[model samples]
Target: MRPGIIDRYILRYFLGTYFLVLILILLIAIVFDISEKIEDFITRGATPREIIFDYYLNFIVYYGNMFTSMIVFISTIFFTSMLTNRTEIVAILTGGMSFRRLMVPYFIGTATIALLSMALAHYIIPISNVRRLHFENLYINQNTGERYSDIHRQIKPGHLIYLENYNPDRKSGYRFTYEVFDGQKLLSKLSSDFIRYDTLTGTWRLDNYTIRVIGTDGDKLVIGRQKDTLLEFKPDELSPSLYSVTMMNTPRLLEFIRAERIRGSEKVNMYLIELHQRTAWPFATVILVLIAVSISSQKRRGGMGFNIALGLALCVTYIFFQRVSVVFSTNGNLSPLAALWLPNLLFAIIGAFLYRIAPK
Candidate 1:
C-alpha cells in the first residue's frame, strides 16, 4: 500500500532523526574511546591510518549495532515529542485517524532498522569483530593464551581424551590419556607422560607411553619410550578463550555449540547465550520504538523535556534488565532463550500497557 502524506512525513522525520542521533552518538563514543586508548595506541606505534581504517571503521559498526535500540528510542522520543509539542499529532488524530493508524510509519521505519540490526548481529558484526579483536589483542590489550589443566573431552563417539595440563603456545601437553569404550566397557587405553605435535608429520608424538588392552581373560599392557599416533583432537580445540565464541558467525557458532555439547563442556552456556542474544537483540528496536512512541506522543506541560527524561529512564531500565538477564544466563541456571528474551517480553508488556493508556 502507498503511504499518505502524513505517513511519508513521519517516516522522513524518523529516518532523518535516527541517522542524526546514530552519527552524533557514534562520534562521541569514538572520541571518548580514542581518548581512553590513545596512550596504548601511541606506545604501540599504531599509525593514524591504521587506527582509522583498521580499528575505528569496525568500531563504529560494532558499537552502532550495539546501541541501535537506544538510538531508536532516543530518536523516536525526540521527533515524536516535537510533533506533539507542535500539536501535529493532535491535528492528525482530530482528523479521524486513530493512534494505531499513526503508528504505521513508525513501524515501517523501525522494522527496517530491526532487520538491519539482525543481519549485522548474525553475520556482519562477527566478521568485523575478528579484525577488531585482533587489533585490540595486538595493540590495546593482550589476551593471554588460553590454557587448560585437568581437561577432558569426548574426542568422538566412545573415545575419550584427558590432559593433565595443556599449553597452547607450546602446542604440547603433559600426562595425556586416551581411552576407548564399548557400551560402558573399557576396550583399550593409551597413557603418555608427555605429548607434542610433530610439525613435520602432522601427528602427535607421545613420550614414555603405555598401552593397555582389555581382554576377556585379563589386561594386556605394553610400555614404550616414545610413540606417534593419530588423533582427532587438536591443540586449538583444547584452548579457547571465552571471547572466541563471539567471533564465530552463525553457522560456525552452531557447529561449535553442537560439538561442545557432545563434549559436555560447561562453558557452552556462554556460547548458547550469545547465539540467542544475536536474534533477541535486534527485536528490541521494535519494542523500544513502541515504548518511545507511546510515552512521547502525548504533549504535556513539561513538554519535550518531560518526555525525553521519561524515555531515558525507560531506556536505561531496559539496558539494565538486559544485562541482568545475561548475567543470570551466564552465571546461574536460567536457560539462554528465556534469559535473553525476558527483557523483550517484559518491555513488550509494558509497551502494550502504555499504548492502551496513551493519548489517542
Candidate 2:
C-alpha cells in the first residue's frame, strides 16, 4: 500500500472511532444527568426546548471538551490494539514500514483532536458553561446568596478590611473595620458602627466612625459622625461567589486576575488553576496519545480487551493525579503551573521510555 493511502486510512479510522466512542459516552452521561435532574426539571417548569437547547447542548460541549483527551487516548488504544490483533501492524512492519513511521498517522489524528480540544477549552467551553450554569441556577440549583458573617479581605497590600455582617441585597455592612499595617506593626486603624455604600458618590457612608493613628510615641484618636471615605471594594465584591472565576473566558479571566491581584483576592489561586489547566490539558492529551500508542501497538495474547481495560485504568489514574495536583495548588503550597503541568511532565517521561522500548 502507498504510504499516503495507509496514513489517510489509519487517520480516518482513528477519528471515526474517536467520534463513535465520544457519542456513546456522552449519551450515557446525559442519561444519568437527566435521571438525576428530572425532578428538578419538572418542579422548576423547565421546558423541553430549554432542556434540549440551553442545558444539554451546552452541557455536551462543556463535558465533552472536559473529557476529550481521555476519550482520544481510549480511541487510540482501541484502534491500535485492533490493528495489532488483526496483524495489520505485523504486515506493515514486515513490509518496510518502521514503527516510528506508523506513529505519524496517530500523531496527526491526535494533534487534530488536541487543537480542537484546546480551542474548545479556552474559547468555546467557558461561553457554553455560562449558559449551562445559568440554566442550572434558574431551574436546578438556586443558592445565589453569598457570605453574610465575618467577611474578611485584603483590598491591597498592607490594607485589610473586615465586616461583621454584610448584606448583599442592601450593599452595606455593619461593624466595619479598616486597618493599615507596616510590616509587623499597625500604623492606623478605622472602625465603623454602620456603613452603607453611597451610590451617588461612589464612596462609603460611615456612621459613628473612629480613627486611631499610632505613632512611635503615642496614639492619636479621633471620633467623628457620618464620615465619607472611598474604599477599594465594590458592593458585589464583598460576597464573591467562590466558583465565579470559572465562568470567565481567557481574556476576561486574565483581566479579572490582574484586578484581583491588585485587590489581593485570596481565591486567585483557584482562578490560576483554571487558567493553567485550560492550556495544560490539551498538551497533556498529546502526551497521553504517545503513551497509548506505545502500550497498544504491540501484539499480545490478551489482545484488544486487554488494551481497553489497561487504557481505562491509565486514563483514570491520570485524571486522579490531575485532580490531586489541583488540590495541592489550591489548598497547599504548590504553584498552579507546577501543580497542573507536573502530571504531564511526569507522564511525558514515561511515554518517552515506552516509545523507546516498544517493538520495532
Candidate 3:
C-alpha cells in the first residue's frame, strides 16, 4: 500500500516544526549565555571575533548535542499531540491504516536523529571540545592554578609507573616510580624523588634515584644518585585533565580501559563509564521518542499543555534515573553497561506498556 501525499506532508510538517522550535530555543539560550560571559571575555583580552565565532558557536553545538535526547522527546510530543488534537491521527487510524503502519515514518525520522547524535558525540563534537576547552583555559582562565594530581599506574607490559606530584602548568611530575615484574617475581624497580623534564633535552631527568634488581635467591638493591630514563610517556599524558578524558576517541578509551585493568587501577571506572555511556546514550533518544509518541498520540481535555507537562515529568524522571545509575556504576555497585543502560531499559519498558494501551 502506498502512503498518500498527505502522509508525506504531515511528516515534513512534524519534522520541520521540531527542528525550528529546537533551533529557536537554543538561540535564545546562546544569547543569554553570551551576554553573561561577554564581560569575562573582554576582561581576559579576548577579541570580538574570537568571542563570537570561536567560543559561542562551538558552545551551542556542544550543548545541542548534549541535550539531543530531550529535543527528540519534546519534538515527538509536540508534533504527535498536534496531530491528535487536529484529529488527523484519528482519521488516519480509522481509514484502514493500522497504528503500527502510521508510526513507520516517525520511527524512521527518530532513528536518523539517533544515528547522527551517536556519530557526533563519539567522533565529531569531541574534536570541537578540544578547542572549546582551550578557549576556556586561555581566555576564561578557569583552570589556571588547578593542576592535576599525579597518577601512579602501570603503563607498559610488566612495568609499573608512578608519579608523586604533577602540575599541568609545568607539564611535569615529581617523584616517579617505574618497576618491572617477571613471572610472579620482582625484576627491576626504578625510584626517583624528583622527576623533572629538561626542555632543552626533551627528556625527563631523575635526581637522587635508585635501581633495585631482584635476584634468584637474594635481591640486590642498587642505589644511584642521578640518572635519566628513556621511558616513552610524558608527565602531561599521565596527569588528569578535563579535556584529556574527553579528547580520547573510542579506540583510545578502550586502550586506556585495557591498560588500567591490567594495572588494577581503581580510578578507571569513570573512563569505562564514559566509553559505554556514549553508545548507550544514543539508544535512549529512540526510547524516549517512543514513549513521547505513545503518550501524546491521544487527545486529552487539557490538550498540548497537558502533553507538555507529562513529557517534562517523564524526561526529568529519565534524567534522574540516568544520573543515579551512573553513580551506582561509579561506586562499583553496578556493572558499567548495566548502570548506563538501566534508564533506557526501564523507560523502554514503560514505552511498550503505554503503546499497548494507547488509543487506536
User: If the candidates were sorted by their lDDT against the true structure, best first, what order would they fall in?
Assistant: 1, 2, 3
Question: When superposed on Cα atoms, how far off is each prediction in RMSD?
Answer: 2.2, 3.2, 2.4
lDDT of 3: 0.79
Off by over 4 Å in 3: 147-150, 216-225
Task: Return the lDDT, model 1, position 24.
Answer: 97
TM accuracy, model 1: 0.93
Better of 2 and 3 by TM-score: 3
Write model 3 residue lDDT over 1-360, tens digit each, in one string: 256665676668667966887798799998897788878887889887877677877787788878888888888899889889999889888887888778778777778888987888788777777777778878876656555455667666777787767776676667778888876777988888877777677787888888888887877887777776677665555654436768777877787778667755666778777787778888898888778889999989999999999999999999999899988888857888888888899999999999999887
Write one digit per residue (lDDT tens) for candidate 2, span 1-360.
888988998999999999999999999999999999999999999999999999999999988888888988998899888888888888888989999898999889888888998888888888788878889989998665554888777777888888999988678889999999988799999999999998999999999999999998999999999988998778867765535666778998898888777666677798888899898998887899999999998877787888888889888888898999989988999999998899999899989999999889
lDDT of each: 0.90, 0.88, 0.79
Query: Which segments of candidate 1 are over 4 A away from where they belong?
Result: 1-3, 143-146, 198-201
Error of 2 at 165 (Å): 5.1
How do all models score by TM-score? 0.93, 0.87, 0.91
The CA lDDT at 47 in model 2 is 96
RMSD of 3: 2.4
TM-score of 3: 0.91
